[model samples]
Target chain A: GAGVSQSPSNKVTEKGKDVELRCDPISGHTALYWYRQRLGQGLEFLIYFQGNSAPDKSGLPSDRFSAERTGESVSTLTIQRTQQEDSAVYLCASSLGQGLSYEQYFGPGTRLTVT
Target chain B: AQSVTQLDSQVPVFEEAPVELRCNYSSSVSVYLFWYVQYPNQGLQLLLKYLSGSTLVKGINGFEAEFNKSQTSFHLRKPSVHISDTAEYFCAVISVSGGYQKVTFGIGTKLQVIP
Candidate 1:
């Protein structure tokens, strides 16, 4: 029983470059979530996916930020033409969908730096 | 609109001493409350949650929080905190609307446990 896992652990890109952060959640978890944490702030909800339902992308700051989860296994969060403000830790979490199981398992986030 | 507020941005306490971190939220409808801990360079981990039942909810790492509906506050408490307790704590609220779950988080409270 492994917990959620994120790739790269760190990402460094230029101001105008694009970056993609990947997340691999635990098996059989039907709900996935993405969050961002700035340097000295709390976690900010970015998006959430529950099974085949349409994702809740309202938390996304702008249209430039987009995420996609393939079939409930992996998710990728992409930032286009990243800006300095886009630098933050992107975290992924998984939970048992349906019912009232709100307990989520988190992964070590990917630290993104836009220089 | 729902929002979370964490007044104290930082709290310093001696090892083995009791500690308290306050959290408050404003919402007209029902909501699920949660407390999460984030170690340095790690993702957020669930500390406790208050959905229904007992107002005083106990969580991992000797942490507990009392949910006060009248006060609209959920304050986390630990009788004896260790050095390992030094981390960032976040209070979050999730409410469903329009067939989507919306999560709102407060500015994290950094706990510094002194030796």
Candidate 2:
């Protein structure tokens, strides 16, 4: 079976521009998550989506960061007015359901460089 | 709220030698612990997890972790390591309180297996 996958493995954009990163979770996964990983740092939780429930946006660092998921499939993370600090690896993960017990499958990640 | 701490930033061990990576977490409520490994240029993968029963959890690639509730720790260990074991390891925890499940990750520990 195909594992979770992210598109545009590498993206370079202007600091003021907006960028959208896409993720395709494994088949039948009902929960998805987004995270940011800066060089030499840990994974920073960004947002989570479970089935049709309202997405968990509490981890969003700022109003400029937002994510959307349709049903239980694809998810897109959009960053508005990106800053140099936004440069990092954007990782996407998914699991069988919405709980801590389920194992998360991660995507290769999209490296965004805000120039 | 939950937080994870990885005591060592790096662990260097000779091939075929034992290795240990310490991790500690704090949370007001019950939690689930997990260990993830990330090889260079690849996505993160689950190494092991401790959700319920069985304090000693085994994972892929001859990896294992022991969950110590009293010490609030879940340290990863391997009896012997191979050069291919060189990678970054991250410890994570999710608080299972209220309706939301928020996961926190520790700053990864880089494992350098010297041959």
Candidate 3:
């Protein structure tokens, strides 16, 4: 893809249900990131992936939130037993990783609304 | 731990008016600074970055920011803004941990350019 891409641009799920947001980063990119943007707030770091190394999960708000990436390609963010407060836009980004400028290319985020 | 702060929650300005959005961060070690913009219904786009260079960094759409190490701030500004510039702006910092990069974001500032 020419740019980062995300699936199910909009999602409506009931409280307690699980949701998975997908991200397809640019080809050959070695780093991927996941972030959350609440209404009227800034982007919040969730998780990070660098090649095949263990992901940085320090930003996950709780045990309900998890993310995984395979090799240097697609990534998935799964939220278990979603809460109303979980309503926000989930964004994904990719970068060239170390040895280059750390500018991240973002996708059109998935807006999840838990009713 | 690294953290970021955006002083202003919202700022309104008339078209063609100059504007500045304030951002500050706290870090124990040298870090990479960045500014990102998010238009309505879109994902974030990197505006500029300060990674060991001149303090003044220029970005797309006539945006610029000055990285002040003393004050620990990176403020975004535009000589003149257009209605299209109405969007949410975020400040971020990249900190290296165990050979991997960890990004932290501040509470965003909404720039509303009135027509």
Pairs that clash in candidate 3: none
Q: Against the true structure, what is each candidate's TM-score?
A: 0.95, 0.97, 0.95
What class would a CAPRI assessor give candidate 3's docking?
high
Each candidate's clash count: 0, 0, 0
Candidate 1 collision pairs: none
Q: Tell how far residue A16 is off in model 2, in angstroms.
A: 0.3
* Alpha carbon RMSD to native, model 2: 1.2
Residues A1-115, model 2: lDDT tens digits: 9999999999999999999999999989998999999999999999988788788898899999999998989999999999999999999999887453468899999999999
Task: Write one digit per residue (lDDT tens) for candidate 3, span B1-115.
Answer: 7999999999999999999999999998889999988888777888999998799999999999999999999999999999999999989999886789978988888899999
Per-residue lDDT for B41-74 in model 1, tens only?
Answer: 6678899999899999999999999999999999
Q: What is the lDDT of residue A90 in candidate 2?
A: 98
RMSD of 1: 1.3
Model-by-model lDDT, in order? 0.92, 0.92, 0.92
Interface RMSD of each: 1.5, 1.1, 0.9
What lDDT score goes with residue A39 in model 1? Answer: 86
Q: Can you tell me which runs of candidate 3 are displaced by over 4 Å?
A: none
Q: DockQ for all models, in order?
A: 0.74, 0.79, 0.83
